[model samples]
Target: MANPVQFLSQVRDQAAKITWPTRREVVTTTIMVFIMATLAAIFFFLVDIAIRTGLTWLLGSVS
Candidate 1:
């Protein structure tokens, strides 16, 4: 097994290699996600309304 000190040093080295995203990138991506989610919700809402309307009309006519 490797020595604890050596392992910790290796871990530190690997951690330093990571490149985190910039603040601007994070903000832009967050905004895009919210916009896409809103669009999806709106689309589903419209589709649900249309289906409900159609079914109501069909059932109403048969009664």
Candidate 2:
């Protein structure tokens, strides 16, 4: 088992090995995420509306 000092050293080494994204890359991906989220929300909303309408029509016709 590693002692506290060795564990901290290993953690520091791992942290240094990380390659952070550039500002432009971060911004581009953030925008893409927002666009994808908006599209998904719109698609789900349309699907929900279609299902609701179909169910309503079916129930109404049965009465």
Candidate 3:
């Protein structure tokens, strides 16, 4: 079994090497992700409406 103290020391050493993002950077990234997601949702909604309208017209013409 591994020693607990040795494992904790290794964890601490690895943590020290990490470069964490600042609060500003985190907020900016989050906003950009949300904006992109919203745009994608709108684009897919338009596509779905177009497909539905086209199918409706095709079926109506055949009937």
**Top lDDT prediction, candidate number:** 2
TM-score for each predicted model, relative to the true structure: 0.83, 0.87, 0.85
- Put down candidate 3 lDDT per residue, 1-63, tens digits, no spaces: 669999999999999999999999999999999999999999999999999999999999999
> Which is the better candidate, 1 or 2, if ranked by TM-score?
2
lDDT string for model 1 (15-41, tens) is 999999999999999999999999999
- Candidate 1: 10-residue stretch with minimal lDDT: 1-10
Question: Per-residue lDDT tens digits of candidate 2, residues 1-63?
Answer: 999999999999999999999999999999999999999999999999999999999999999
Question: How good is model 2 by TM-score?
Answer: 0.87
The collision pairs in model 1 are none
lDDT of all predictions, in order shown?
A: 0.99, 1.00, 0.98
Q: Is candidate 1 or candidate 3 better by TM-score?
A: 3
lDDT of 3 at 55: 100
lDDT of 1 at 45: 100
Kindly report which residue stretches of model 3 are placed more than 4 angstroms away from their true locations once superposed.
none
Task: Give per-residue lDDT, candidate 1, residue 4.
Answer: 100
Descending-lDDT candidate ranking: 2, 1, 3
